[model samples]
Target: MKKLVNCFIGLTIGLFSWTGALSQISIEEFAINFSQPVDIANAGDGSNRLFIVEKVGRIQVLDEDGQKGEQPFLDISSKVDSDASEEGLLGLVFHPEYQQNGYFFVYYTATVNSIRDAVIERYSVSADSSLAEHSSGVEVMRINQPQSNHNGGDMAFGPEGNLYIGVGDGGSGNDPGERSQNLTLPLGKMLRINVDNLPYSIPANNPYAQMGGDTVREIWAVGLRNPWRFSFDDNYDLWIGDVGQSAREEINFISASENVGGLNYGWDCREGDIACPGCGNNQCDEQTFTDPVHWYGPGPGLSVTGGYVMRGEFYNVFEGHYIFAEFARDQIRTLQLSPGRSVAITATIPANNISSFGEDEKGRVYAANLSGIIYRVVEAGILPVELIAVHIKKENKKVFLDWETGFEFNASHFEVERSLGQESFKQVGIVPSKGDAGEITNYQFIDQVYRPGDYSYRLKSMDLDGSYTYSMNLTIKIENNEDMLVLPNPALDKIRVGLPVMQEAGHLQIVGLDGAILHRIAVSPGDEDAIEIDVKEFRRGLVLVQFIGEGNISFTKKLMLY
Candidate 1:
């Protein structure tokens, strides 16, 4: 028995029983225009406001109270070299305890000593919150780049109260200094430091801190190409999206639980588990090397865009999927990876020339296009619960269904369908819709029935603008069976499934909850190794593991890799 609220306007809406969603919402227009919007962040301070960073070194503010203010929060273009597309203000991050500290960090290309280099600067907002004082910008950490191109840009704070920075391999072409794997250089790696210490100090427990060599103690993971973006989930696991050179693009997952530091992924040595012919030595020891859990080649429109592991409170269906985008590929791709398997692509949200993906305080993902359009991803056709309670009654014969259209996009009408059995469904009532809400309108329907039976209902909303979407199914079930044994629920690092212990060799496909295949492995039963797959190369979140044995027995299990 679920409770309903009298929340907003009295709206009658369809019901969501257990499964079946109502609609899929997409970006209708760009949120804010920018010459090049690299990233966006929300205050998370109960303020539905967002901060946008421009490539040319300016920060713009957009408030959710329906207010849009234009004035660079901080303009460093005069101090930065905005000539090159990649040279300007590259990254920005708000402090985890920003409400009190008011401290924020920025990564930019500064012309120091007549040589351009990447620098991270710390700034504090004024007591009035109107502007950040110019003198408050303090030098935190700086890394000198050998070449111009691979100036690793993004910087973020992990859940463990450490600042993580992205560093690309020293520019020019193919691993010139072989710097990605070299612990000495900060290029081409993810570095973490504790900001609680003065300025910033390397965390003592960092993976490479005890290497005893001249390596940077702050180096958390190395052997990466140009890692433009990296983020951590609530569980403190790290997710990295490294832009590939030519052949492939890869995403990585590092579990905080493992505490396995110094994770040296093969960069110039290998791209996504396949040996680079030019790098020589086709076969190398697999023990010391970590392979990418998810990777893809340069398809028609393909370039690795970083995404977020759906950890927001938006909806359950998309709860744990990793959402990413492709620049040249122009698609929002989600990756779900399980232990002992590669990362698999789950969902593909189409867009034109999308460059970056962003997440707000609510955990909703945003896609910004190179064309200067920004679209927030939302549930296409959804209504509030309070709206679902009205006109819904268990009459003697049939249930009366009525719902007021709340937020709609190109909505045509509501076609109510019912099912006694989960399979067979028939049209019961038709409710007409009046397109987009120039203004809200109410609608109703009734199914006159004589016998008492279980039923399920769904809304088929069509867009007069030529689009169609369905709502989550509403079940009035009489009885149901015990849930299937979906083993390895929320698997961490690794997973195993028992299905009569087949002795056949077949292929295995790992998928996400959304039915997107995450990993496909060729396996031979009776092999002792149990197939060693690294999730470090894929995005972190909930994933599905599917195994097809030689006997054609298929098994599916849900897994979560931190």
Candidate 2:
């Protein structure tokens, strides 16, 4: 079995306390059992689904909950060339208007008549919305491959909706054909094309789009050995993970805002910052090409697996970090770029065989390995409470709050916080925790003096080392002896109900418009003021949330699920 590590905030603080302790990030398994997964992408649709590209010519779907679908969304194994380990289905991207056009594209290696070639094709989703129609595929472009090892099968859509394809120099030990620097060949260059047209059209802004002679109009940038993976950040800046020939693995970057192109990235001339040994100084002119933004010696890793910049809210600490990994090292690392364009490794994750890095619709990052598992990246030391739920309720003249935790590691206490209206929460009360325990622990607090109005409450879980994380905010309305608040009206996956402090017990029911009761939850005096209910499994539409408290105090609200 593969070794799995689950580090809950406070439990592994010491393990990540490095030079920049606060900058480190951690990982937890998200999904497993994939066959040679090479890439991951989202449809850009509101469905919040993830598409995993397996190198064996299939695309698997993972729902928002990280559960793999029973059937693949797309499969084209018959046309894929899997004879070479590096050849097969390699890249996938959904059109910017995928939600409307249902168009998606994939890059793969195809074998025909004992020769292998790289192909890019577009496909549309099936009428069922869950599966892709293989028959809907239309060939977009195809390039003859001289050798299979360095096919450079990765494609991504730029901010302008143009497709950028990475092609390796005709594969061999070195650029024997000098194809990278040759403006006439598409090999070893980033190609840009407008795929909205039949057979694709060259982007007008491409470096050689209008150049006459033997110049290939699709060339964008040149001199890349094997750019295995690359991505565009929110700013449309391109980042490339170019596999090294002998000494260094490099990450090349280009800002889209520059608008300048036709630049050469030293490959045959230079492996990284140094000259390629035995290649001579024929084209090894440092001033002639752009050097990589970052590069590493061939010890800790071999090939570079470029990842996305952290734009997700789940890991706030890594907000602007550029995450990347190595194939041989099996390590996930982050880079922080200084204002001067210098880069530094801020964190490292001890993983194995990380083949690719992916993001969900919400921007949460995930890593996939050759071992058939994917892990979600999270901030290492935070959320010490591990709270299962936190709620609040209001009675005749008093308000009560309750919370439960599945486990606590070095937890010292809980600070009951309150805020009037939308103001910041203030410390109102403190409840000592059960110290450090692995079993379930429940706690509660009460406020006897409070005016009738709107109030919000949250729990501040504190650790012995002064670290803390806050729970989800729970709000309540104190009106004429009644209190209830159904939150996150437009819910994506789950909904929460805030109950009033009660003298006895009550029952809460969620009913659909068709007069069908979907759930019935019991509420008691010491129960949490707020209760979370998973509504993702429910149909998307309007639903009634009803709560009947002691003394027949009832309240209802309409919820919209999407």
Candidate 3:
């Protein structure tokens, strides 16, 4: 999660300043539509698949091409209670080691014997990797819900690998039972636990894990009315959107590195720095509880929906701002926090009914609307070039770079920049582009003098009017060993291989797992530095590409065909 602070450049179209100032932001609608979509997430398995959760207890799967699967990944509608507006499937998270274990967890509300309960369950993926094994589900924890509306249903895995769950104050209006201030209850609190075991084990560093005598050991923080949505930033700082009681909506911030947990947010006693009527003598004590970082009166919005801090690569002005929305206002706003705990409004989005926010593995942010639509956050203006894909490969001692663009408008040229380590990138080569093209175009460049190390490559596209923008960066590691470079991995249709000149006199074979040769090609001396192979005929699974040199020097590299 390295920050690209220095990569920001001022272009002729508009100069962006990182200071706390308002910037124009826009949203692009995604192609796929969902039915009351509440949350969206990626599995982090490098498969580039998106999992969308609907409020009616079903999870839909979408591939990288925006095509949804024919069947739902998981369905629990029979066991879930969606009678109320806010009581249904709420959250979903994949295990940090899900690529190996195939384990995932979900939070939902179920009814049994006419009583509603919030249940956290874990399920394993089937052998097909596209569907879940519903029969293998095991309940991890269940809490009885007294009422329905205020059930806080947001959950996420923190950077420390512990699960954090946000709970509401047992669902009455204005402190009827005073559950938030009660230390013996898990309601209206943030809970942390380790799910590596069968039944979850409380983390040893939890604030009240070892405390006995009716104190809930799973409680990490208390005093929340209804935390509808919450998220952790790249720095692991916790941000929550606590819906207020009468006239206020608030956003609270807690730093994971500085705070030791056990913080009281003052729900029944106070509302957003104001004393609650008839609760605890009507005298607010600022020293007793932690106040919200930002709050607003009930005019433009009613309930706040918390969103992620802008760590995505699409916008430079939104790099360090916290983005959130109000359910009633249907507007998205950004907050910038200074070192002295001061907050300022940076930008506003014109979206509507933003129920939740989501981020992919590449840090791209998406907004899920309760109206059954999803939008991706993007910069306000159009770019000179629409880059489709970029690939880099190390061939022998030279590095080859290739990219494709769907369209180009008023384009001038593309500068290929290379960086060693995490330092600033330098221009290595430049490729001229078509001034204007409505069809697909391809370009390539080669760096013949790069050293052996970690390198990153990016394209800086400049327009005819001198305005420019950058494409997403690609990183590749070069080793001293004699390993061929493969491009566009997890490839579709075709793959290109780069080999060293010394190893050109060899035989290359594409072999399946059953020791059957699917394709073979003879390597001759003085052949080209790269070879393109059509893999559309290969089966969709794991295959090995082996090379046998003149001295019987053979090595195999695993290739995934899809």
Best by TM-score: 2
| lDDT top scorer | 2
In model 2, where do residues sit more than 4 Å from their true spots? 1-23, 284-287, 299-301, 382-562
Clash number by candidate, in order: 30, 7, 0
Instruction: Please give the distance, in angstroms, between residue 159's alpha carbon in candidate 3 and its true position after superposition.
Output: 4.0
lDDT of 2 at 382: 43
Ranking of all candidate structures by their lDDT, best first: 2, 3, 1
Worst 10 residues of 1 by lDDT: 1-10
Model 3: residues with Cα > 4 Å off, grouped in runs = 1-23, 277-287, 299-301, 382-562
lDDT (C-alpha, whole model) for all candidates: 0.65, 0.79, 0.78
Q: Measured by TM-score, how close is model 1 to the native structure?
A: 0.63
**Model 2 Cα lDDT, one tens digit per residue, 82-104:** 77878889899888888988899
Q: How does residue 158 of candidate 2 score in lDDT?
A: 88
